[model samples]
Target: MPVGFWVFPWDIEDEGIDRFAARLDELGVTSASPSVLYHSGRALLPRAREHKVRLLGGPGANYPFESLETPLAGMESASAPGTGKRFWQGLAEARSDRGIRLNAWAMPMHGSELGRRLSVAVVRNCFGNPYSYALCPSHPQARRFAESLVGELARSRIFHAIQLESVGYLGYRHFHHHEAEYVGHGPLEELFLSLCFCDACMAGARREGISVVELRESISRDLERRWRDDVWSVGVEDVREALAANDDLQAFISYRQATVASLVSSLAELCHSESTELHCFSAIFPPTLEHSTWIEGTDFAAWSRVLDRLIVFGYTAGGPGAAKVDEGWTRSELEYAGRYFDPSRVNVVLNLAPQYLATLDDARRRFRTISEMGFNDLSITNYGMTSETRLDWVPELGRVLDAPASST
Candidate 1:
């Protein structure tokens, strides 16, 4: 199996490139996914050298290159504080020295400053409340900005592959700073409330022959009733019933899927044109859990058509304090995703922190299971959170990964 590590710029700077590369070599890691266009922080190190430095807060691009002028003007771009070495340049040097593949980790639509600056371009719910965490995919300016950013990353020719995150719609709930208390909301209700009724979204729904006016009114009335009752009904069937009852709602969901698919397709074409591969971090929809696509507008089947690889975050085991471990959850999620994506191209990401895995023995068990399933690609959650104690498990995992496929 080809093992990869997800690293932050802070990790590289805190631990010099030589030390970082040495650690990766020790762990048998073959690739590194470093965050480049990160959210709300820029690398402050002069060069990508060893130093203990914290990332400064604020929304801006951290790439070494200047922001390409686009139709949407005034996009912010910030270079690293010291040596002003672009992030890609630093990673390129490490790649050359360590002989490791470099994959650029990018967050496309989760720009806090951009969303707040252009509130109209942010995602608005049925109640006309804007979510500052997400830029509405249907917004023309937001779409153009995302497309332009992806094009720039692909054209850079520094990354072996661009791993895209947050490329779809965000729902009503977010882990924002100083989040307020909004109780009595069910998951299904949250999904309903998260439906975007912005002008662009409404226009798309309208074009799909959905009666946006009627759908908005219906959703508003339903939400009011749920809020007054202070009760939420669970299960996917409840969502199915609601959609089945409302033709316009069903049409709108379909429209959202098509819109997201089109955007990804366009970006994938651009990546292919540059001879760069495009991959996306996708949420695994367990059969028992709420289907995330309902609110996020991610159609895995559609995305598989354009994406080169589908990286599923299949962390079946819970963190340190988890009530119980469900060993079957990971396999189930992977199998479910296998229906839509090629098993060979599906990279399963495992949680490496003690909070997620109880012990090295537990980690070994998970690795054996993945190998038994014939998965050839695996990745750790991140390098920043891998504690000194957990670091010991890396080489052990490498041993299991090197073993031949199990017949079981």
Candidate 2:
């Protein structure tokens, strides 16, 4: 398994490129995924020589782009992707000297700056309220903008591959800063709330002769009634049952998946034309990890046909809702993934922090398990968020990954 790290620009800039690349070498890392575009957040960088805390927002052109021509004009990059000329210069050196394959990572169709643009409708709920964090890919302008970003990243000539994140429909859980939703919406409720009812979605449904108007009304009424109910509990079993029962709802979901798949195909075609590899982090934002990428309109079968590699966060692995993460969890997830994607085309990332792996033994055991499976590529969560102690886990895991058992 070829290993890589999902890194931020700040990580390179703050740590200096030589030191950064050296860390990768020490960790036996062969590839690097650096963010070209990222969401707004304040990150406490542990190893930074300069400022420890960095605030990131907006698009950037650290690598020689002509102009700031996208939807984000005045919004200059606060945590600029590559810190001016020094970053590119250092990155070029790293590539030439280390043979590191650089993956230009970008978050598409999930930016508030792009979503709130005048021409974009963003994603809307059944109640028709806009989700500012999401730019509906079904929107013409948004689709074109996504094409523009991918095209530019592909054409940049600096990357061997381009990784796309949040490339589909985002829902109620795609939260903005300081978010507080007092009302508790269950997993099923959140999924319904996340469903887009924007003009583009409506049009797509209408084209299929779906009674969208009545469907929306039915959804709104049901959600309202549920909120007013004193006791409402929906477990994982309720999700598939509900979808099976509601034909119109199922129709809308199918349309969303088709629309997203179309967008992914076009982007993949664009990347191929530019002679760049395309990989997408196809996992949906959770509360519904059981459905994987399905909940957010990403049809894995459709994606399997197009994407050069589909990256999934196997963060939760078990039965429905990941209710029990037993020893067979990873094997079960791989089997489930085989239904949609070839195991060879999958890149599974392990969140090496305390949040997921939790211990050195757990990390080592999981690494050996996946490596012995021998088909999927493995990527560590990141260089930026991980502490030095956690990063120490990579060298051992990396060695285990390269063993004969994983060479099949």
Candidate 3:
């Protein structure tokens, strides 16, 4: 299992590169995966290599759904064509470099009308619904756009693998649309709010005989009624005015997960043609959040056959229980994930911040346990997000990286 660190090169300058590379070398860390960015007509891969860190070329955190900004709408005419071109060139350079491996990390179905803010209203109006923030996997245009984008990226020849992310619906889409759907239902009832009710979404669902109008209307009415009843029972009868605001957060998780699976299947086909390896990283929450919806919707089975690797997000900072390193939890999660895809293809991202250097021991243990469970690769969260103190954690991380994977 090869281990690597993640960094943001968008802000990394030549001097900063020297410092970072020095740190990595001192810690005996070799390969590095930095965020993709083109600056001043040049990419950062060369500088990183000068520091002796292998660069993984990528758009960093570019989300496919939100890629369409009005100013940079559409794949062909997307923002800063030169940025991508420079990145491709960087990929070529990295390929020539001794240690780098360039991969396109794509956030597949991550929809956030909230993040788009001003533009979201336009998207909602155009799609004829405010709730349809995520691109409907059932939608042809979404698939076309995704395929075109991947094709264009693959043309660079610098990328050896394609990393898929989010690939699920918005984190809060279900919450925004269907809080009432589960009203009058069991408190613990499972909810996976399904989306894509726009013309495109509905039409796509029709192919499978799923009714868009009925589903939306049902949710709208159910939640509204439940809210009204709950208010009246509490003698807050005047609260009908706020009835429209009621929504279940869990529903968003459900919808997001389903969309992930659909989009992954579609994108996997596109990546395969280019002979590029496909990988996916979780977007919604850390594994401890118990996001089974994401796992099921973006079925690892679909990816295992087509993808070259699978990277699951095991964020610990806000993870349930003790954010502290719990090897038992890490082991269980890795073992569970190992059941889905080849252990070698699976990697766990350990988010480390320099500010959290005090937790280095815990974080290292988490990585060790995960790697021991058969995962070979480890992705450190972000270079930019790390603090000076967090930088202190690098040496300990190097030790964990060098430790042999558990034999069991």
* TM of each candidate vs. truth: 0.89, 0.91, 0.68
Every candidate's lDDT: 0.73, 0.75, 0.49
Segments in model 3 whose C-alpha atoms lie over 4 Å from true places: 13-32, 36-84, 91-96, 111-133, 173-194, 229-262, 287-291, 316-321, 325-329, 354-358, 404-408
Q: What is candidate 3's local distance difference test score?
A: 0.49
TM match of model 3 to true structure = 0.68
Please report, as a residue range, the 10-residue window in candidate 3 with the lowest summed lDDT: 118-127
lDDT of 2 by residue, 1-408 (tens): 588898887788777788888888888888898877766667776767776777665543334444335555444366774356557656967866987788888877776666655345588889988888788878887787678778877876678888988788887777788888666567678777888888988988999988999998988888888888744446776677778988988888889889999999999999999899899877544325454456788888898899999887656643343322623556666666767777788888777766567677777677777766655488876788888888888888877777767352
Q: After superposition, how far is residue 69 of candidate 3 from its true place, in Å?
A: 12
Best of the two (2, 3) by TM-score:
2
Question: For residue 37, what is the lDDT in candidate 2?
Answer: 71
Model 1 stretches with alpha carbons more than 4 Å out = 40-56, 68-81, 85-87, 284-291, 316-326, 405-408
Root-mean-square deviation of candidate 3: 8.8
Best candidate, lDDT: 2
lDDT for residue 175 in candidate 2, whole number 0-100: 79
TM-score rank, highest first?
2, 1, 3
- Residue by residue across 185-256, what tens digits does model 1's lDDT show? 666686776688899999888888889988888888888888788877677777778878887787888888
